[model samples]
Target: MSDPWLPSLITETPQAGFELAIKLSRMGVKMTQPSDEIRKKLRVIYEDDADSLIAASQVIAINYQTVAAANNCWR
Candidate 1:
């Protein structure tokens, strides 16, 4: 079976990765990877420039909302 986190990590755009790491951090989800270097990078991206990260999240939310509305799934 494929590792579930691999898709999210590999497919994420830079903005998406920043937003996702922030969300995961807020949810108290700790990193499980063995590589401390990768974890440190993720932490830096999520903690640094947090406002920009949040803005990216807002953009993603808006895009999803638009798509759902277009599909009549908003109701």
Candidate 2:
């Protein structure tokens, strides 16, 4: 099955992408939202120059500070 969280980042605007990133980060997933310049770089690396291709963030799995908390402070 596809990842449910994928839609939260890609199917919406930049602000929503930011929120999703934070939410995932709180869950210990380190993610980075690609800026315009970074998008250009990714296009180069992936060699996908499609105009409709949206840049996806790089998510690294690891234990982070936010996830170490006993409670969800983001709420």
Q: Evaluated with lDDT, which candidate comes out highest?
A: 1
- Global lDDT scores for all candidate models: 0.52, 0.40
- Candidate 2 per-residue lDDT over residues 1-75, each given as its tens digit: 334644323423444445555567534412343366765665476556443232233331221222322123323
Clashes of each: 0, 0
TM-score of each: 0.35, 0.27
Off by over 4 Å in 2: 1-8, 29-75
lDDT of 1 by residue, 8-43 (tens): 333224455445555544433234565667767777
- Evaluated at residue 2, the lDDT of candidate 2 is 31
Error of 1 at 49 (Å): 0.8
RMSD per model, one decimal: 9.8, 13.0
Spell out the clash pairs found in candidate 1.
none
